[model samples]
Target: MPDPVLLVLDTAPSPRLGRLTGRVDVRHADASSLAGLLPAADVLLVWDAASDAVRAAWPGPGRRPGWVHTAGVRVDRVLCPELAASDTVLTNARGVFERPVAEYVAGLVLAFAKDLPGAPELRGRARHREVQQVAGARAVVVGAGPVGREITRLLHGLGVRVALVGRTARRTIHGAADLDRLAARADWVIAAVPLTDATRGMFDRRFFGLLQPSARFISVGPVACVVRSGLQDALERRWFAGAALDVSEGEPPGPDGPSRDVPGLLLSPYPSGATVGWRDRLGEQFVALYEQWARGEPLPNVVDKERGYVPSADLPGGAGPDPGTGPRVNGSAAPPG
Candidate 1:
């Protein structure tokens, strides 16, 4: 058989595919060139995890790849009807980002609790003050996936109380019904949930209203009312005490750009998964999975496309499903994707 043609949707400092150079037929394409390149490829490595090029170009009349892999966790920007309905298999770099993102959350919690950003200004003015305590603080973490669980663990280590909420109830995890009540009592509300219809606008007006005025909301993925303008509105109206948004609906200001001008609204360029050598980590992960695919082995981190993410039950070595919910197969028997 011929070497599998691996078409990588290119991004800067492209994937270090040197390991597979001679073993696979590697091709490169960007948004403008993806459409013409899709037909002949046997596999597509969506290296540009944030691009919508794959969604826009996947439906054209031609043979599609047998497998698609994204370098990141969330698959929202790449999923479309054609790709979702096809027999083509989809995979993601799920475990790659969990701890790094969780650590970022911990840093945010510390920054907010200790008022790190305001420290320089206060020091310059020689002002002394007391900041709130992180230990003994209450946190409500949404999403029960690996990333969410890791965040909960880190926060718990810091002596913060945490209530973990997921799509449905399980042994120790809370279900969706308790979110509002939990948020009402929490000092911090951290969202690590995937972007599905069920979770998309789940944090809108009513959700924000449930948070304590002193609560700080931080989202690793997209959250409703946490986007650019929405955050501005919340700050202007004094809806909540403060917030940290890692993902937003619009471009973030550049490094030398003006201040957001809105107090208590922290903005980050979505670097939750961007630790040093992280891209290299992702490349190494893809190469290992690629080797498995080349040998026809059962792949890990298979995404339940219909659900838009890799279901918790489908994670590598995941326990077969929560007792109440039936076995998770392609998310067909699971809750809303």
Candidate 2:
């Protein structure tokens, strides 16, 4: 029997798939060539998780891959109506990012509290300013997923009170309804939810207005979840103390972008989850999942195409079980690919 064709949507440093060389026939494609190569592929590995090629090409393809996996946690970039409605199973790099991103959020909380971003400037100007304390601060971490849970755990270790909000209320996890009330009193409000119909533009003027004037905002989620203009206006008007965004809607604005001059605003080009050796880790993760698929066993991190995320049963007083293991799969059996 011919080896299952594994098509990779290539990126700068391609995933090292040497382990699969003998077991799979691997092919590479870019945005332009992706559609042409989709038909024969038994499995599609979206190595360039940031690209929208899958969304654009998936709808125009012949037979789509039996299983499609993205190396990123958020599947919105690759999800489209066609793929979502098909029998093809979709999965993401869920376990790989939780810890790194949570650590990044913790760092941002500390940086904001200590005003670390302004320290160099203060030294250069011979000026002094007082900074807030992180311990005893209150935080509202939206999204009850692994990343959010990790953030909550890290913040608690720092002596900060954290309110973890999810789609619905459960033991120790607040529901979406409590977000407004919680944000109003929080010292730090973090957006960690995935981008879905319900979450897109969730952080708008009203939500920003709900924050305390001295509070800080941090978003490690997709850029679309926050309204850029609303955040800009809020910062300019001092509605909140400050904000740090790791993701941007498009090509992040250049140095002269409109938000550049906005005081108390910091922007990073989506690097929260991208620690050193992240790509290699993602490669290893996909390889492991592929092996599971080859054995016709249940694949972990299988995304619910309709909902756009991996659904998990809520655990009492927590975000759920170990995310590295993730939710169990039931009917995702398929021939070795």
Choose the strongest candidate by TM-score.
2
Residue ranges of candidate 1 with Cα displaced over 4 Å: 13-15, 60-62, 123-126, 223-230, 247-259, 314-337
* Best of the candidates, lDDT: 2
List of clashing residue pairs for candidate 1: 307-337
Can you write out model 2's per-residue Cα lDDT over 156-183, one digit (the tens) per residue?
7788878878787755677788889999
**lDDT for each of the candidates?**
0.77, 0.80
| lDDT score for candidate 1 against the true structure | 0.77
Total colliding residue pairs, candidate 2: 0
Residue range 168-210, candidate 1, lDDT tens digits: 7665677777778889999999988887766676666666777
The alpha-carbon lDDT assigned to residue 263 of candidate 1 equals 76
Which pairs of residues collide in model 2?
none
